[model samples]
Target: MTAGTVQALVVCSTASGAVTSAGGPVSCGTDAKGNPLYLSTVQAYVVDPASAGYFDAIATPFDYTQAFGFWSVAFTSVVGLYFACLGIGTVVNFLRRA
Candidate 1:
């Protein structure tokens, strides 16, 4: 298959779950039960040279698994700061009325 094109591979198997012929084109032979075999697809992406730098700049240095903990900690810190500010405002209002 050409670049950026998806290609399907048809795999044939017997009734006992044994593979017969694999890696054939989309129009593959039937299985032992006279039924069509399963089809697997493969694709390749061709990126333009001009856009490669843009993609690199937007890509994250850390994977999602590592970023999850960092985001959770940041969220908790923001919530804590919000409550602290609220508490301070309440105390200031109480003193101003006294």
Candidate 2:
């Protein structure tokens, strides 16, 4: 995807139950044909706050791909702000009677 474009993708869970994805674009650690790696590995661990050690394990399992969407409306808002500020400033200056 090009810059300024929003892309969405599903990310699996990590050992700490955290998920991560590169965001947008079906590229990243893919095969030669541009296919996803399909690496769905779940991680489980029990942290020992005192000893800072605990039991941890991982299971490689594929999960459903969570569909995400992205849209751009900030540009429109920025343009609107620009014209609004210009108009307001002009009005204020004109009414100042200076």
Top TM-score hit: 1
For model 2, how does the per-residue alpha-carbon lDDT over 1-98 read when each residue is reduced to its tens digit? Answer: 12132334344322222233574333236556665554343433434444332222234343434222112356667889999999999999999977
Candidate 1: which stretches are off by over 4 Å? Answer: 1-62
Tens digit per residue, CA lDDT, model 1, 40-88: 4434366656667777888848688778989999999999999999999
lDDT of 2 at 93: 96
Report model 2's TM-score to 2 decimal places: 0.28
lDDT of each: 0.62, 0.47
TM-score of every candidate relative to the true structure:
0.37, 0.28
- Tell me the lDDT of candidate 2: 0.47
* Residue 40 error, candidate 1, Å: 38
Q: Work out candidate 2's RMSD over C-alphas.
A: 19.5
| Pairs in clash, predicted candidate 1 | none
Candidate 2 Cα errors over 4 Å, as ranges: 1-71
